[model samples]
Target chain A: SQTIHQWPATLVQPVGSPLSLECTVEGTSNPNLYWYRQAAGRGLQLLFYSVGIGQISSEVPQNLSASRPQDRQFILSSKKLLLSDSGFYLCVGTRFSYEQYFGPGTRLTVT
Target chain B: SQQGEEDPQALSIQEGENATMNCSYKTSINNLQWYRQNSGRGLVHLILIRSNEREKHSGRLRVTLDTSKKSSSLLITASRAADTASYFCAVTDSWGKFQFGAGTQVVVTP
Candidate 1:
């Protein structure tokens, strides 16, 4: 059984502050990783995805960036947060192609 | 945008009743997947129906896909209070690009 974990389940930060969210998957290697953000009362928007280490694809050009420093570790970061950045962020790991498993998610509030 | 669209943005049903949601997309797809999201939580993949397949079942859930119509439907039988969540249908293109619909929020009352 594989498990996906995310840190800082909830965050509240002022505009222009730096942001860092980490996601790790245990029991799987070379898995596809994705970052998605959901605005309140809205559908999810894919921010970034990685096929392998140091290979990140941006679905939507945004202020946030993603890094796959390790095979099982994926991180979402921002040098400066925007008020529009306030939303729920999700980390997903897919094994065997397309069966995606998601983490608990982090709620970010940019004040 | 070729993103999928779910009908009945919101739905409320009594416990033990059936709940149905429809999703329509415009484009060729390799597969369509259904996911459930509890309030303010991450999504959980429910089922995936390949373009070659028309229907699939898992436990009390039934999913039907019509490639000709570019549509899909999800039916949850004997719904429970725990079934209250948002349902989203995601379409995956041949290149493995995935796009999700706005989603249908379902509420099952006891």
Candidate 2:
């Protein structure tokens, strides 16, 4: 079965702290990877997407960045966390011809 | 501006009743999809309707897409308390970029 894995289900960090969240997919090859942030009581905002290794597209220019180091590995990182970055972060993998599946998601609380 | 926008920021319904939500997009799409997200959980894709399709159903869920109007609707029949969650509409463009709207929070009471 196709599955996506996200690490550090929840995180707490003070403003200005560095951040790193990882996501990996299994049972799929060359799947598109996407990063999204969801604010409380609001819809998801697309942050970044990767179509292939070393190629990334950012939807919003913010304090975060995404990298695809491997075919199945995607990472979201920030040099300094901001209070506004406190939100639920989700990793998604999509089959080129079909719908996307989500990882369990990482909840970041920047105080 | 976001590509898709869901109507009714919130909704409430009794168990066994039906729940419906609407989504409108700003541009033409290759397909539209609906997703459900439980509190503190990742989102689950519920259904997808292609631009060439009109209506599709999965169990008790029905989705209708009107490409001409750039709108879609999701209907859940016999909703249960467990169905309480946020429903989001996402659109995929020809390039496969997904854009989502603010979700509609559905509360199904027992």
Candidate 3:
């Protein structure tokens, strides 16, 4: 079975600080990866998706960006975090069946 | 703009009652998927129904798709308190990109 892992289950960063969230998948290679953000009481907004290393398709324009450094590793980074950047960030990978498997998620609170 | 819209923004039902939520989308879809999220956490995959399929069942959940009308519904039978969560409908286009709906919040009272 495949498993997705995300680091720093929770974080509290001050406004304008740099941010980094990492996600990795085990038991799979070259899988489609996605990053999503869900604001409180709102639907998920797609941030970025990568089909391969160094290839990213952004869905929404924002202060956040995503990178795929390795086959199974993805990172979400921001040079200067804003208050609006606080939300629950999710990392997802598509299973062989075409359904998505999500990581535990990282809750970032920028104050 | 959202490609899919789920009806009944919120639903409250008893533990033994059945809960049904509907989703409507624009344009053609290759597949429609249902997901559940607890609080503000990541979404968990529930079920997926291909455009060619009319209905599918898994455990206590049933999903029906109408390609002609571009709509889908999810039925949860004999719900439990643990089923209290927000449910979302996602549609995949021909290129396999997933678009999610606003989600329907379901509250199962015990």
Candidate 4:
């Protein structure tokens, strides 16, 4: 089983502030990692996904970016935050490619 | 978009009743999955049915897939209040890209 850990369970940031959310995986090596954002009462929007170290794919054009510094570590960053960024962000990890295990998630409120 | 669409956006039912939700997708998929999300928490994977599979069961969960209709259904038997949450259906294409539905909000009252 793979476990994903995310930091700063809840975050409050002002517009234009820099943001960095970290996600780390345990019990799995070289797992695929994903970052998704969900607005209140909406479906998840895939922000980024990584298949390996130093490789990241952006699903949508936005202020957010992703990095996989290590096999088990994935990071979501933004140089300048926007009010639209406020939402619930989720980090997911998968080994077999079909089933995904999610982290507790981070609630970001950008004012 | 390849996102799935869930029907009857919301549902309310009493405990011991059955809750069924339907999901329809736009394109062909390699597999379809169901997930549960409690308020203010991450989503948990509940079940997965491959394109070749028409039906599958796990404990209280029953999933049926119809490739021809590009749709799927999830049924929860003898529901409990604990089952109150948002349920989402995700479709994975052969390329491994996944798209999730807006979700069905289910309220199981005790």
Q: Would candidate 2 be rated incorrect, acceptable, medium or high by CAPRI criteria?
A: medium
- For model 2, the superposed segments whose C-alpha errors exceed 4 Å read none
Q: Compared with the true structure, what per-residue lDDT tens digits does model 1 show for residues A7-61?
A: 8999999999999999999987888888889999888888888888999988888
Task: Give the winner by lDDT: 1 or 4.
Answer: 4
Q: What are the lDDT figures for the candidates, one per model?
A: 0.89, 0.90, 0.89, 0.90
Please give fnat for model 3.
Answer: 0.32
Model with the higher lDDT, candidate 2 or 3: 2
Q: What is the TM-score of each candidate against the true structure?
A: 0.85, 0.91, 0.89, 0.88
**Residue B35 displacement in candidate 2 (angstroms):** 1.4
Q: What does DockQ come to for candidate 3?
A: 0.49
**What's model 4's lDDT at A98?**
82
Model 4 misplaced stretches (Cα beyond 4 Å)? B14-16
Off by over 4 Å in 1: B14-17, B26-30
For residues A9-40, what per-residue lDDT tens digits would candidate 3 score against the true structure?
99999999999999999988888888888888
True contacts kept of each: 0.26, 0.48, 0.32, 0.39
**Per-model TM-score (chain A alone):** 0.97, 0.97, 0.96, 0.97
lDDT of 4 by residue, A56-80 (tens): 9888999999999999999999999
Pairs of colliding residues, candidate 1: none
Model 2, A17-42: lDDT tens digits are: 99999999999888889899998777
- Candidate 4 residues B32-74, lDDT tens each? 9999988757788899999999999999999999999999999
In model 3, how well does chain A match by TM-score? 0.96
